[model samples]
Target: MLMRPFWHRRTGRPAHPAAGAPGRPPRGVFPRMGTMTVLPPQIRQQPVERAFHGHVFSDPYEWMRDKDSPEVLAHLAAENEYAESATAHLAELRETIFGEIKDRTQETDLSVPSRRGGWWYFARTVEGGAHQVFCRVPAVSTGDVIADWTPPVVEPGTPMTGEQVLLDANAEAAEHEFYSLGSFDVSEDGELLAWAEDVTGDERFTLRVRDLTTGALLADEIPGTFYGSFLSPDARAVYYTVVDESWRPHQLRRHELGTPLAEDVVVHEETDPGLWLGAGLSADRRWIVVEAMCSEFSEQLIQPVADPSAPLQVVLPRTDRVLYEAEPLLLDGREQILLTHDHDAPNSRISLMDPADLGRPVAEVALRDVVPASDTVRVNGCAVTATHLVVSVRADTTLRVRLLPLAGLGTAAQADPVEPAFAEELYTASVSAAEHDAPVLRLSYTSFTTPPRVYDVFVAGATGDDAALPAEPLLRREATVLGGYDPADYAVERDWATAADGTRIPVSLVRRADLDPAAPAPVLQYAYGSYEHSTDPAFSVSRLSLLDRGVVWAVAHVRGGGELGRTWYEHGKKLHKTNTFTDYVAVTEHLAARPDVDERRILVMGGSAGGLLVGAVLNLAPERYCGALAAVPFVDPLTSILDPSLPLTALEWEEWGNPIEDAHVYRYMRDYSPYENVRALPYPPVLAVTSLNDTRVLYVEPAKWVAALREASTSGEPVLLRCEMAGGHGGASGRYSQWKDTAWEYAWVLDRMGLAGA
Candidate 1:
């Protein structure tokens, strides 16, 4: 859903403003306010006139886009200094919140182990360690598959009989200021490990291989690679993708061990600038699935893992804008490709097709429907094991997992699917890991009040219970909360907000159980109304700080997100994007009217595309909030989408419409773009956070928006920008540093809500 590939600017239909129309008078030129007061940074206006689609617009502060310039850097530093001075009184509050976050967290912990081949892989986080330690222990197996699949019980910080440390991330990241582990994949035989690291947070990684048995790294060092790199089954080569000049992963390459990097074969290269390329190994490890995808459509290519040099076979040529994921399956002594696709179904469905008919035209090939499309149920994904078909579906606005026996799959006698039961009405359950021969399915479950829990669902060799899944889920572990945290302390409920079009939007809220509804309390409203990414109700250790301080947190499931269904997403994108902003406004009004929420104390927050939502809604109804926080905001959508050279711009055309090629889209985008629509409104105090190295949404966006707000806002509230000098789309990298960032934001929001001393 994010964008870029190199393309020249295109102009379609042309529209222009009146000849005599003049831009806003030069503003934000005020001298230091009263001298004694700490003044915000005063950025010099360097107007750049841009002409596109017969429209000429003047962009002051465009010079901030030159990130390498000394003036821009100095201005950014000054902004940081001003922000620190303005909130200097909150220093104690920030430290207190940080302490609460650290105290409530289990400093030394271990993840639930999952069986892969003969080893049980897991990760450990030691006290005071900023990164995880990847380690594996020998997996013992019995004659029965179900019994053999059980994960061994290992205590935290304890050394096992035969435990091998794969790669200690703390040691690897010790030399870098910012560290991110991109790919950490282990070979099938457990002899080799392929991992990648990004030190600067730009997302381009360097891949390295390690010989686990010898406890030494191999000589293979490949740089400038993207994420999702994997090792071949035989360990002779590694498959990875590389990004182009525009930061789109466009090439899928195979690098053989001990060979020169130049000799690496190009397995597949995506010529379409909008499509991204990535590869993954199938569950059976029989085929390498290379997918070239965009938001609207995708094409999958399959290559036999037995032969690394084999030519790829197309599962289905990119046609009719169909989006599908095909997985190899074995049923009834025959191999078939199971596809969860949106060919004719909006919510999607599961179908079966013969492997031989993969390249045939849609009209020529026959596909048998296994799970028919339903308006109520959206089949999002599927995974196959040696015995069962696992499907993930969203219904009732909650994600659930289902299981179907593979005995008669793709036939008339196929068994009915059974869904496992969960206690909570609003929670997320998903398949975390699935092994080909394993008898158990690893699942991850969480809710607003409940901490994350890992479970193993046993389904193999069951005949007595055909109506329901045979065995009860075995709980492997639940995340540890150090400070006697209890789910009963909080309450969660879903309320409906009616939009202007009479659409009902769902609002999920969590507040302390003792908070009285008769007394209005400050509320923090959050949403990410783009990319179909749902902001589900999940537990957060740091959020407890706000809840304990009488702050209520709520999530608005707006139309642009996939919380409801595909139709909900379709109604809030491209030309219909304004629905996203209006929905947030509706939610704000609804919350303000509630007896439990204070009208003058609500603050808004979102990141990335959600940040755009925050900006737009603030402009629409600034009086509804006390302050706003936008992180790496895509506030300048019109300018970014017009220039295809920017990272991920071309790829974004599918989601936001091709504004460069369409005049209507250009005007529509320009009308509501936060930076373009800044007027003399009673805007609230705003905090914009960004990273200097983020390629997805450049820090320049918030920089420009901050300048425009200062110039146009009628309210004399402070506008602040906090830029991370060495971070990426995500601010700081280490766990400790991330905790501090969270504390800083919480402190700022609390100060705005008059709860800084709470």
Candidate 2:
């Protein structure tokens, strides 16, 4: 006997809402401005109960998960139509915001050229073109390495000498409704190119090879390959990964250029459902490095490229709780392994080890520490060039880069590293491109109030860390802004909010300079507190529209993020996950109490895991916000995590506890899960944006959440859901479509803040 859900028995609504008339929706569903009252779509509640670990809960909208069913598709369409009719008044504001964004952006531009072998690689975007054009010019190098490595100056509208167009993505995107480039890699010889494309936005790509000389694709075509696939150094083979039925990338394979698809070899297979596998050629092009990792731990293996069919050697065996990444480096006529690991240091440290000592127990091998661990500094990553090693680190709440010479890299006489100076108090700077043998390191730098800039740091003449190369960084290019823009018009600053546990959460604020803190203004608060992923401050051209309209923007650096270091992330996951939600609420309360902010006009926003944060916080303090935006939210987490067959569900067990095996975890998740905890409160208006093909955080999660909110809310505010019919995790594919998406969201935010007329 099947048991009916509690909601079904309590409400007694019909399973299907009959049309008021033939070929017409219910009268209130698509009401006009002055003609009829606007009503949200009334979703049907089917009888479904999930019983696990002695807990039974009603799932009214579980049928929405069947994405291929006609009923589900029709419901999604109705939801979209309702959202459009409700916001029909904002059509003018959306268009105006989109125009402002397009006007400030230089539609036609060229990126800074980067040197590879004998060519300078760069991308060009023509006006009105939705996709980029990959092209390159012949390289001209002099005997002096520093002078030879400097990037050549090229104007945006002018053509460079000996330039060749490799690929025009516009022509390829014209064939599909949605298009995304999965992988783009050129062989070391610079003659063969390996690329991939995804048309349906499901993220399953098909690989293809192209000859640069003749501009013709070969007969070699492999489907269902993952991103980051690359060609071998000799240009005779390609290496890629394939996802399993659960969408976990677990198989690493190699395909010879002229072989049949069935003959492709599986280099390594990761049977563990919790781990994701990836393979790439080392920077020096001497070895193929394969790695399998999860949120808490990882293991690495390596194979010499000299023997394409050689067996993979274990560089580091799997340890229960230790995480590490090992890269091969050729130094002083010998090969050494550079490892960044969290063995004893919570914030990772760098060390060097010999290749031959691998495959032995990690405790039995000796390691030379090049960059020692520090409680104050978090080493993010390291990159090596022919002359120096560039280490990216997080200190004082911002990302910066340090340079260490390789002359005495692993020895006792190694000199102290050099840290470059930047003018801004908060900025992101890191190595953008570094050819293994190139003399200059290319850096991409930006901040909240600064445009993107490229620089070339000369390091060819330096002998050791203490040696001086060049004091001034050579500026290559700064992204162009079509309209007259001045950084002085805006002000950026940092503030602190006290959490329940006395921890100070960092909050970044940006707005127009003329706005006075004493005068209250509408505010939009954003955050993402999960997966140890940091939401660093960045410059946004579209955001100028919000700031220029006298609205303040804020970013809450809450727990469960890598912003403050490993401990910050540790305190916000698993059992401590509530800290993420509380930290965000604390920040919101702090903003409401500020003299510069209007307490009644504050709005909150987040996407993906951040959307989870938004959902939890709304349930905690719904009155603190006037509106909210959750993009591709993970609302029904316990249900997804309990079922291991779902996409990437097993991989998420480490981040969120295994609710199926642990009783405490199951109850804790149920207490916080947005769909399960939508109590009868005066919930604010919510706009959930999702994609029909988003595999990471499925559209079903948001669909269920919206239905629950509409059912339980005490306030009359509308809860709308906008699902993209043909898009992936990211909404639509092209730049113009993305601009329109941004405009739509921003216009809604302004309307809620009573600034739509501004």
- Model 1: per-residue Cα lDDT over 1-758, one tens digit each: 00111221100001111211123111222121222268888888989998878998899978899989999999999999888888787788889989989998888898988998899999999988899999999988666555567677778888898988898899999999999988999988889999999999888899999998887889999999998899998988999999888888999999999999989999999989888787888878889898888867888888889987788999888975678887876677788888878878898888899998988766676889898888888887877877788888888888888988887776889899988898888999888887777777888899999999999887755434334443688888899887778788789999999999999999999988877666677789998888767777678999988888878899999988888878888899999999999999999899988877877778899999989998898789887788898988989988898888899888899889988889999989888899988989988889999999999999999999999998998878888899999899988899999999899899988777766656
The C-alpha lDDT values of all candidates are: 0.84, 0.83
The window of 10 residues in a row where model 2 has the poorest summed lDDT is 2-11
Model 1 misplaced stretches (Cα beyond 4 Å): 1-36, 144-147, 462-470
Candidate 2 TM-score over all chains jointly: 0.94
The regions of model 2 sitting more than 4 angstroms off are 1-36, 462-469
- Global local distance difference test of model 1: 0.84
